[model samples]
Target: MSDLTKLNSPELSQFSHILSHAVKVPGLIFLSGQTPTDSSGKVVEGGIKEHTAQCINNLGKVLDAAGSSWEKVVKVNVYLDDMKNFSLMNEVYEKLLPSPKPARTCIQAAYLPNGVDPVIVLNHPGQIGAGYAPVLDCHTAHIACKFAELLEKIDRRTNKSIEANPKTIKSGDSCIVKVVPSKPMCVESYNDYPPLGRFAVRDMRQTVAVGIIKSVEKTDKSSGKVTKSAEKAAKKK
Candidate 1:
């Protein structure tokens, strides 16, 4: 198609004869799946975490060739050789992508090129559901018991300036907490919708802390604007 423009990265020139790193048309860019291969087309050495980073890094080159960036990516598809590596792969992924992360689908693949552990495809500038849900802030009202949890901590060395690790929190401690919903739900800021913003921290029959939602970060489905909402509700104290 004359209108379709193929985009190729000099760093990934080896793929030119077989495939374009990406294609562009008007307002959208479609990027091909990128593996952990380097410019020489050899799989990089490392574990799944390192492999995932390389895959996203390769995509970055294609995005640059297309005059686009990761922030402009609206959808992504991740292929993993094993579901067990999902968490390890996500460790690298969450750090690389920017706020309001793109909509993504990850599934296990029976096999991957070059025996790589992961492959990623990216699509730019379009609406796909509500986009990624990012926690704006979490304030702990109270802690009922001691537990270990993965919490986001400041890491100036990383691009995102934040990293997650399991930290032991003691009972009766007041600390910041992060909540991740298992599925996408319509959420509003506590300031905007009290009823929708309220939430409770519970584990089985034990109610930990009850508090109103301070804010939720999400991309509007239609306008694509990032919005925050708060909530007010009751919880067992």
Candidate 2:
């Protein structure tokens, strides 16, 4: 872990600008964190209103690049450096509107320069099938059965009762049955991982169930050492 005390948080004079002239038509114009700065990137001597207007003007150039005006933007996201100046920003912001106003949200999320993907968690140790994973770069087979046994032990210790999440994210939330079967017994989807989507179901290994669960495949050889492709992708995520 890095030292938080040594972290760098510089007081920026002006926020950055991005421009793309390739795509035409109704384009997006981002008015980024417009701090007080002059045309030469120098700090200007003015109030927040001046800096805010400059930011709006800079966004106008971006809008012009697509041969459309700022009035064409259907959406707008605002960044408030000074909460005290929010009303000032709003008053200036309303000027950009012609007849219909853009949909807007007022909050303090970071000023991300461009688009980004949503992140998700993987290998949740508390989740089912997660215990089967090898720890600390250890061999997966060595601890694979340990994880399975741990489940049986947990069931017996906890009276074999389990609860299913009503609005579950995955099949791992399946309920565990306490009672023993009479004959031709089968528990339920008690060993399945949480459904991650079509990708997870598609990339599941046939051998994980056959070899690991049923012991049908010889795992003593390197050829037998394999993991679900979906699990690999999940790890990457």
Candidate 3:
């Protein structure tokens, strides 16, 4: 019921935190998140596929503490650092769900887990279902989620561009951004497009979703797509 998104991270346990309060509310976790490596403080090494799998496992610990599991998850917002990793990343993700698929949104970020800024809602899945957003201040997480969604639409040349809001700006050109379920937004072109690296900041206080402009390209390099959660998502019924 508030605009607060916390990316849970036990490794950076001292970054931003909360009390051992009951789950009287639903919220996003990840006050800060990074690549998966170890509970003892070692980020696993590998390509997008390896890092992603470990990241999801690491997220499990965080979600569990928040009293929510990926099965209870209603939506998954992804931040891929490289566009080339998109397909491989999706292949990894599609396999993780448990069924009745939750609405999913994906975006490419320059980085994630650096300072840990991905948040998760702690509410039970029964509290929120597909097609609806979490009843929490996922503004930070949600904003990035929406920004990615909006960009997708625009990239499709659907004609709707992102409308800038003044209050949404936490600083600099960043605005207090929000995405409409379906609305008309004017698209504007810029010369200095923000780099993916700048998007996923390491230690940010606000729910910051950095926007990137790019064209999807095809490559023949073997990605070896893998998914450990997709079947779980499909069998949850």
Candidate 4:
């Protein structure tokens, strides 16, 4: 077997049917392109700003997991579905990355997945201490196919949520930024959280999972009794 070591996160593994989050071979680490998606692989609904934030947040998570950080990045490749959003994406990108920014390139592509734009790839030097490799990098792409079933669940719940309050939500607008999975807890952690807005988790996927958190809330509009079965049925549908 090649001495290549694979780096993966439970969150990324949740989408393993599509791609490996990252692959490492001592001196180099390669990360897959990250799109704005939740833990269950739902495409984020916000515009390019949200998409860019989600992409960078996802990358940062993987880099931290692999013993590297943005400061170590030596190169960057940005792919945009349209050139018009170039300035907007850069505004967010520059603010998030550390000083002495890495060499960079930006290009407009004919298309990007999930109708999303500005997929970013970071190439950085990995941790080189005490026997670990010294170079790291990452790329991301929108997810599909592998996420069909999960998407179905989400869609069903979304339909149910809309049926509950058509006026309050015309489209996907709410997201669950924080989840206490073990406790079976889910809530709208952020008020009026934008669709596909970026959320993150640091150092604890076991206790918490974060991304573009989105979920359909099932509550009785009149009596206000939460419908547990309704939510479950929606997910099963």
Candidate 5:
């Protein structure tokens, strides 16, 4: 239409009818935010990290169609349902984008369309290394060795899951580990895989807790000094 250029691609056709993936003019281009949906419009498997990867991939397709590339991108806006995922998302983002990085802004949303609620831990053995970052980001060696070590300790303690919070960090081997202590409440009915399916469950077997560590700080041991309620006490003295 006129001098405006609209772009689309088979790889990113899921929302073609609803919206243009990108639009280019004489000197500038505007790109729509790509979600984790595949060609068929279904949300992709894997957790936020994987989803973010897919989104970037989709953007690549759109960029290619527009005759542009990551190197040309001037800005990026990332929307997350949970801000805690900032680190994990960074991991994948750093791997994909070009040097110097694009001007970017990330904001947490109360909800994402695919129902990726961060409050639940959605890793079943079938979807191992699926959702939560500590597990999802681990490699085969980490799982086979580090995870096995943690599992052995759990087995010895007669526990289904182990808690390593406040663990003394004597070595890299010693770090926090998380697990679902009980069976997931909405398991058999949901099989989408990883974090999305897990987060999609209408009800749960128990309370849910899964995610990355945000911050840690040392507290002051000194007690607070009492102060007079009013300056009148000093004046009277």
Candidate 6:
């Protein structure tokens, strides 16, 4: 008989099809990377510190389901969207994982699973039909520049309360635009991770504008409700 068994937890049933939670052999067990999502599949609300805690909590569930414990964990691998969060993430890691911790490796990833926020910064003035004009319901491309190499197609955007709610943004206007990515992507605030912060606005093949991240709002993966929000001061020209 192959002394191998697959481990699972009822709390993680929603993610069962994605992959086995863990695998156990005679003397060792291998676990998949646990995200900061809850049992209901919603990303927990908070910063990296809170996120790190949730990941470990989820891992504990799988560990218990496998008849194992964190004390037996021999190795660990952490993938971070931004290395700048290392210190904050480490603070939580040190508190949760026991001493004489498992061998671990941490690396910055170009992008993660959730999604990114797109804020447009208009540099030049919008010309009537000559320059770029973004309407309320039009889809546009949000190209991540700097460190993150991602091209996310935005389905639509909401206008923030600025003077009057403008339906169409001209090329040179200064205002806040809220956009949702067509797909999930990893992104960080410009203040927190500058490399993942800068991006270019594209309409078809033309680059319309460029901007830095002012805020981030993450939606629930299952319910699609806004769960977390982070804001930063927009730079003055």
Q: Which numbered prediction scores highest in lDDT against the true structure? A: 6
**lDDT tens readout by residue for model 1, 1-237:** 789999888887354533788889988999999978777655678999999999999999999989989988999999997899999999999999888899999988655555311111112122211222222222322222211232333321221314344252233222233444543455544444434444444443433444445456575667844333332121111
* Residue 207 Cα positional deviation in candidate 6, in Å, after optimal superposition: 35
For candidate 5, write residues 1-237 as lDDT tens digits: 699988887675444433798889998999988888787556787898999899999999999988888998888999997889999999999998879899999988654544522223332322222123231211111111111112111211122224333222121122223232111122210113322222211112421222221111222335342211100000000
What is the lDDT, from 0 to 100, of the residue 51 in candidate 1? 94
Reference-based TM-score of each model: 0.48, 0.33, 0.39, 0.48, 0.48, 0.49
Mind giving the per-residue lDDT tens digits that candidate 3 earns over 1-237?
565544444543222322321132444443234455565444456777887787777666667667677777766677776688788887877786567666877786543544222222112223212232211121132221122221111111222324422222212222122222222222211112111111221123532223322222222336642211000000000
**How do these models rank on TM-score, best leading?**
6, 5, 1, 4, 3, 2
| Candidate 1 steric clashes | 7
Q: How many residue pairs clash in each candidate?
A: 7, 0, 45, 9, 1, 4
Error of 1 at 192 (Å): 58
What residue pairs are clashing in model 4? 32-139, 33-139, 33-140, 33-141, 34-140, 126-134, 126-135, 126-136, 176-213
Rank candidates, lDDT, best first. 6, 1, 5, 4, 3, 2
Candidate 3 runs further than 4 Å off:
1-14, 17-34, 111-237
Where model 6 places Cα greater than 4 Å from the true spot, the runs are: 116-237
lDDT of 4 by residue, 170-219 (tens): 12232111112211122331212323222222221121112332333445
Would you list the C-alpha lDDT of every candidate in the order shown? 0.55, 0.33, 0.37, 0.45, 0.48, 0.58
Task: Report model 3's TM-score to 2 decimal places.
Answer: 0.39
Better of 1 and 4 by TM-score: 1
The local lDDT score (0 to 100) that residue 4 gets in candidate 2 is: 16
Model 3 gets an lDDT of 0.37
Per-model root-mean-square deviation over C-alphas: 20.0, 19.1, 17.9, 16.3, 21.1, 13.7
Ten consecutive residues with minimal summed lDDT in candidate 1? 116-125
